[model samples]
Target: MKLAYFPGCSLHSSGRDYDKSIRMVLGKLGVDLVEIPDWNCCGATSAHVTDENLAVLLPARNLAIAEGMGLDILAPCSACHQRLVIAEEELKKEKFQKALKETTGKEFAGKIRTLGILEVLMGKVGPEAIEKEIKTPLKGFKVASYYGCLIARIPRVKTFDDRENPTSMDRLVDLTGAEAVDWPFKADCCGASFGITQKPFFHKLSGRLLDGAGDFGAQAIVTVCPFCQLNLEMAGYKEAKETPSRTPLPVMSITQWLALAMGFTAKQAGLSSLLVEPGRLRETVSR
Candidate 1:
């Protein structure tokens, strides 16, 4: 099962662990990820808001390259997945395709399908297949699976799970034999939008998510999006400092948890990149 892989900008920089864990997990699953050639940024928030055509053109160019490969695209970043999916959907229309071709110098047929790594894991490779690869089942590990707001909000673009109450991450957590705690705010925004400009609102929104997970007695918050993990951890830090009662929960990537349980060490899974350290969780996996 070879697919065109798009790691996006964040995966290579701030989310390097996501790339490492994703590659490790897919390699073990017998799925080959061929990265799209000369892939450019999907222009997630800024491009779309500033220049609409440029936004579409950015992701469309990447999709056009994948179309040549004759394989579906597997995007790891949530924003990249959303941008690519949205670009594909828009390109299907004649008017958008015409403008896109003028800008990108290539006519796009929207032949390639875009899927987040989560969709590929849950649909293309079954959980049972992942279960067979686990060296240590994450028993007694209570995790809050945070999907953020991008992955499944648009059912038309990403039809993998319910937008409001997503359980794909939960199901993946369950495969590790970990307890996926039932908690509200699973799909809530992590306030990535205002993380820089509006610090107070950013902390408030992101802090609430961390607080909610902790309130539910979640030991760790498992997330698929790097922005969410980064923001949540940032907010968690501020939240912990102000409120002594709140113990900062370790925010981990989906693949980080999977890679660790599947016999990969913390260093191998890029656990050191995480802001909030999983001290006990690391100790448990080490033992």
Candidate 2:
């Protein structure tokens, strides 16, 4: 149960809650994550667009470091996972590998197996195992899960499931006895860095997703990516302020929601900090 873990920049910064909860929950599930040494930022949004070389090299460097340790990598953030995966794929290209090795003095076989944290958990433990661990049932909750772009939408890459219609979240929700309703916007974008550069624009996109969730009778939107959580809650709240809604759907990381179902404290699960608390869902779990 030991694997190389890449938290990426967001996990350490705005997504600290994600990192904390991930560790706690994994420990609860009996998994060990060994952080990669001196791992640099994954280049995120700007890397691939501005300079392809840097985008590939940055994650490649981390993969190289992981390979050195003889451990497969498990990435938590979708962006980081995508970048690392993309870098690994790029290095596999005969031309790319030769050029990269000569320039960077690094050896890459694309040998490292990169997995999204969700993939590892859902596969290694299986839905049946997770079901047994649920201390409280989320019987009354209706959560619409969000997967965002990078994790499952990259064309031709190893998307864990269908990009447009994902079942990973739905499966996890079902294990906790919560209903998982079909959400068309499950694979939609939340406007990455645009959260700052284009706040208004991103908020509108986020609002559309939340509005979609509410339309589907969702009590909350569960997610694995932090960027998705940030936009889904903070931006959705702002939009709800401008336009009144019956229930401002709360945005929750899958980790947080799972912790809640397992009866973890509000502080431990980072619930109260959310602008729109999953109060209704909280009541459901307490019972």
Candidate 3:
């Protein structure tokens, strides 16, 4: 299966592990990723907050490029996915379509669909297919599947999973032979860009998530959003330092964990780049 892959800015930078694991695991599943040529930023938090028109147009340009390829887009970053999805919806309207044509000189037919990583996994690549690729099941590892906020909570947009309580990530975690601990914060917001603008508030929000995961006995927190993973890991690290008795839960992209289960080495999956080392994951895989 060939699809247009949009990794966004974070995937190439801070979320290199996510990008590596996604490419490796999808390759194993025979899914070819054709990156959109000259793709621009989706204008996530910044553009959306400052200029609504620019926000829609930014992703609209990328969508127009993908439409030319005649393929659906698989955006690994939840922020990118949300932006692309929102742009597609807006382009369907005559007003935005005209604006896109006038500003960017591009005509978007809105032919392709934008999907999140979780949707691509659960909807396109079934659990049965993934199970067949697992060489080493994470039998004893327990993880809290963190959906963050964007993946399933876009208003007026049809999401793949339940907005209030998503189970796609949990189900995928189960296929990896890891138990997905039931937790309330799976779909909660991780304060997104607030981690930069409002440090203390971000810490308080993310800290609650970390504490909740530990409270539910999760050894690690699994997520699909790069921002969410970074925020959670940063929060986990800070919390650990503040309270030496508390163990920091390693935050991993869902793809990272899947790649490990599919027999890829830690280095190949980019686990070593994580701020908090996944020592428990290594131990569990070794057993």
Clashes of 3: 0
Please give the lDDT score for candidate 3: 0.90
Most accurate candidate by lDDT = 3
Off by over 4 Å in 2: 98-104, 240-247, 283-287
lDDT of 1 by residue, 1-287 (tens): 99999999888888889888999999999999998989999999988889988788889999888988888999988888888888888887888888867877777776779988788999999888898998988899899999999998864754688888999999999999899999999999998869988998897788788889989989999898988888888887666678877669999899999998898988898877777778798888875
Q: Per-candidate TM vs. native?
A: 0.96, 0.93, 0.97
- Cα lDDT for residue 72, candidate 1: 95
Q: What is the lDDT of residue 171 in candidate 2?
A: 89
CA lDDT of every candidate: 0.87, 0.82, 0.90
lDDT of 2 by residue, 198-234 (tens): 9888877887888898899888898889888887777
Per-residue C-alpha lDDT of model 3 across residues 1-287, encoded as one tens digit per residue: 99999989998899988998999999998889999999999999899999989989999999999999999999989999998998888888899999999988988996789988888888998888999999988888889999988999889988999999989999999999989999988888898999989998898899899989999999999999999999998887777788878779999999999998999887787877888878767656643
Q: List the residue pairs that clash in candidate 2.
A: none
Ranking the candidates on lDDT from highest down gives 3, 1, 2
Model 2: number of clashes?
0
By TM-score, the best candidate is 3
| TM-score, prediction 3 | 0.97
**TM-score, predicted candidate 1 vs. hidden true structure:** 0.96
